[model samples]
Target: MLRAQRAARPTAVRIDGIVKSFGGACAADGISFEIERGTIHALLGGNGSGKSTTIKILAGVYQADAGAIEVAGVRHDARTFSPRQAWDAGLRFVHQQQTTFADLTIAENLAIGHRFETSAGGRVRWRAQHRRAQQVLDQFGIDADPRDELAHCGIATQTMVAIARALQGVEQGDERVLVLDEPTAPLPPGEVRLLLAALRRFSRDGQTILYVTHRLGEVVEIADQATVLRDGSVVGRLDEGEIDHDRLVELIMGKRVQAVLSQHTRARRGDVLLECDDVVGGPVRGASLSVSAGEVVAVAGLLGSGRSSLLRLVAGDLRREAGAIRLAGQPVDFSGPRHATDAGVAYSPEDRLASAAFLDLSVRDNIGIASVGDYFRRGILNHRAERRDARRLLSEFWVKAASTEVPLSTMSGGNQQKALLVRWLRLHPRLLLLDEPTQGVDVGARAEIWQLVRNAVDAGAAALVVLSDFEELVEVCDRVVVLSAGRTVAELDCDGLSDGVLEHAVLSAERAAA
Candidate 1:
């Protein structure tokens, strides 16, 4: 009953020593792996570890400089392979970033995946498409209204929608390969559970899944096998029975490493740094909270508890149906994010890689993006000043990179996040908003980022940090705000903040509200 001996079904994909280089630098270095039919295989790596390169090659975005890719035993000429070919041959990739139309309904996004409707008729008849979409969505336990905009929903729900869209091709018994690149990055724990369970059920239905993710915990919980990558090379493969968290970490970093969760000293006494009064958004009740200067304020809440949405309201990223914000006792109205910026607010968005990076730009340019006002003058270029400052930030933030001039997209995700931190910190803003600040960031990088946040607070900046990782909030924040269904329910100081207490409060508050 060994895997290789069972009736000899063709593999979903076989990546054979694929290599890719950009600008004379090796992006993927001789990587190889095989994903079998109807199995959930994970590609585990930190950012810049060639995960992106390998997936891109499989998706036909890159022509590998060496090696070959085989889909269902059919070898692809790396130089000639294209995404259209991959799709025509029954492979689909759902990116971490939003690929669906923002203004379009969920049904429309799914309609694009309905292979049978490739009519030459110049019009897309969506009535039939919705029915088709519903049939597929029904299989995955998605019951959301199809008329809702894909972008309007939270990242977790949209991700489910994305999965639903991708599976349209698979449910037809086309021998499809579904590659999900960090699909759970934006999901809360509950949604994550749903996704994992759904994926497991899908595998039973005979779909081959190649999942790429950074969260090691998720790998342990769901993946049957994991392939580790580092600096464009395949370091090792952990079969279903072989991988554990510690072993996986060792392989992922390409060296033995320790998990260093950040712990910090709280700022006990401080002046009022930021305050919001009577803030209102849909599903968010009249909410009010404050963060002190020289201190970190943590916002903890259950899924759909309005933690992220509240932070979004305060940061000017999301519109407030109504509210008043005060910074240093001055009245302010946030017309939008730029208005918040003018008021000296810098926010690191929850979705770091998708929202924060300039993919085609160099590391220097991305880090230097927020500092342009101070660095540039009279519309004249200052190359030396920019390079000098960029290099300084990279060193200070401990951003791992081959060189500062390297393309931002080529760096590991943790490094990309570090660059974002440097970019925001360079502004020296009065109040900082960090949503899931260290998400997808490694243990070492996470610790360093915490220290950096402390340094910022020590320099007298107030911060409102929203994180789903309860441990992170406990370590860094001076005050805790627990929200339930878009309203601030309970506010606790550091004295009573433990995982159990916080969890209870958030849970109780949610239950009572419900």
Candidate 2:
């Protein structure tokens, strides 16, 4: 009956004929979709398919070239819609980045962008503000104290607080719409569950949520309705009964993609190319692993379980406190990343935007920066040779960019990642240390990246990868190493591995450690 009643509710938002373009690229080509009131409506698409552009237009970050947006049955010009107007109309957005300050109290974080409680004499009412924050926290099932610092709370709790802040003063009404843009992208497996539960609870309380995410599993779990976009046009819409993992992927990819299975026969494992004998550094508490030539070994763990730190330690980005690292049977200690690179090792960090990518530079520069010496002749840089090599690498890697001269930031997340891979592959490294190599890429791009890695491994290279998604781990890796509390707990072959089996191993190990 609740579902039936929700289905009968009026449309919370209706986007009609929305069109946005960027330098001949049609980002939102006559996009149209209707979000039902008090339902969790999902907007999904591949990277660069214009999901972000449409949301930005609705959020007033970008003005649509032509279209109309109807909120609560009243139509408004998309071109004239501003952020202030969107806020006034009860449309709120919670982005993927951590927007809330960890140093501030929960009450103070809530008070931002909203009028603080004050007396007529202009004195701030701290007690009243705390009381209101407590009420909001209680409404969201958050267990943290309102006066406590936000950093004291867990990641999921912090995200819930951000949602609570956006939803302040929003009641069970028709005008309210909360947009969550990849809210779980940065969260771990456990935290993602908590946030998804909170979202379901919010929808139950008549909160209209427009959720945007690439994780189809989350969509299957929470979304009552979903709209799929491809190449800036609406391709398909799925109702509650029709939303499934395979169906959603079909709509997103415009083809029936096979399940990510380890069907491709791997090359025979060669000699151990890289070995960490009880390696200790950063959060890695005596963790040990090994990767052989023609093999891909995956490090599987929850957040802060030393998955990334282990990779960094191997790449010489982190100082090794103890233990031995053997590269092709040589006991060598690298002082820094340059030493590791010089030793034919490539490492890609987890946070690509901050550590790996050069967003301000052109695609050509970003790709060729690592190998600039090869294009130098007698201390003079050869610009023509550099451009030629960059264009060849871009074409070889299947990177979709307008031109080599375009800024790297102008490319989609997937293309940027591909370009980064091209940079590393050009080095012809013997061992690849990749931390979440396909972190923010789409499904099609993810397949291409795996192919690229396979091509490298087939050519006498080895890869050690850290994957948060167990499904991806089982799909791409020949073996999985489980980490718990910065320790290697268990290892399993990927012959018949399932996410359930992998997760069970992780949880059991964590429980034993506890």
Candidate 3:
């Protein structure tokens, strides 16, 4: 039966012995894999493991040093392949970054590469273009007006528009491949489900998909096959029958990683470091929680369940509508993040690129930007002192970079996150607010991040984290405060918490309200 299925579907993408290098460093070292036609294949690996390099080779962003690529029975030399060649071969890509022009209307964005009807004198047929764009949007079940600006729509809608535009000219029976690189990275959990459902519908219609993500749960849910990459090599491949959470992690990490969070007993919980009394702001409604000094507390909930909102409220990133916050027995209302920071509070938001990291600046600049006053003397900027401080912080945080002066964009997501954390950790804030601290990070970096959080607590700093991964909550947190629909539901100690128990508590809360 398996042989029959293989023979029937044929191969959509075949990458043979692809080798790509940059300045004596091998990004993809003789890697190879085949994505079957009409199936969703997951590309899994850690940062610096060559997942992006291989995808770039496929999308024509990087020319392979040596290898051959075959798409839909048409072979192309890796050395000569370009992005245009890949596109002409029916390979489409929707990368993690937004590709649509935010200022342009949906119809105009769709008509980017291929414009609408034009008159002999060179006038664009606006009405016809809008109608055609609407037809495509309706076909994909995307609810948006073609005449509306793309910026007005949500990220999920913009993603669907990008995908629809990619598939505009291709026919149903054509052997087309769509590579979605972390498409759901910017979306909420509810939006993620919607995108996955759309991918399933596409697969049912015989469209091939290459799904790249750090979320293993998503892989198990949507992928028909998975190719695990480690150190620029194909470690293993699992068919639908072999894919599971533990097995996939083992393949990616090359070991049986303990599935649960680390079990460590701290000395003891200290005094109440931070407190929220009936806080209501953003999506949070009458929520209450507290973090004791030297303790790591996690806020647990589903998306839109007020987990992040609660953190933002405490961080002063969002304005509180009612209720009060107290720090060490003193009631306080912060005017903004700066006021909070001055009051011994630090926050790391989930969207690192947008909210946290300075992508255009150097690693040293990003690290030392927060504490520049420390190096200042007589109001004169001290470059030498700043560099010294940055070097020390980089070494302390174990941030992997070519040099401290290198652009923050040169580092991987994990290293960038470490830099951001180090920037705040250096402040020795009394309270730390981390929202999805390890959202897009890999396993190794995750261990390092947890260790850093624990180190902060050890130094008498309290931590209140918001994490979507329940296992992580079980591992690093001493206690978890469960929120349901913007209200604090239950507080469970992590000392004896199991994954099943934590999941049940959250789900039961969700269902109870439903």
Query: Judged by TM-score, which candidate is best?
Result: 2
List, residue by residue over 1-514, the lDDT tens digit for candidate 1: 1122123345788989888898888878889889878888999777677888888888888878888888887888766779888887778889977687778788888876555343577566666666777777687778677777877776677877887787664545568788998888667566677788888877767788998887777787777788988878988888767768888888877666643323455685578878888788866777788888888888888667777787778777787788777888887667766778778888788876777789899999898876677766788878889988888888887888878898988776777888888888888888889988887665556767777888888899988888876645675678898888777788988654775677677778878988
* lDDT by residue (tens digit), candidate 3, 479-498: 99999999999999998788
Model 1: residues >4 Å from true position, as ranges? 1-10, 101-108, 115-131, 144-157, 169-174, 281-285, 301-324, 328-344, 350-362, 369-383, 402-410, 439-444, 458-460, 470-478, 492-511
Name the lDDT of candidate 3: 0.86
Deviation in angstroms for 158 in model 2? 1.8
Off by over 4 Å in 2: 1-6, 113-127
Ranking by TM-score: 2, 1, 3
- lDDT for every model? 0.78, 0.88, 0.86
Model 1 scores a TM of 0.83
Which prediction has the highest lDDT against the true structure?
Answer: 2
Model 3 lDDT-worst window of ten: 1-10
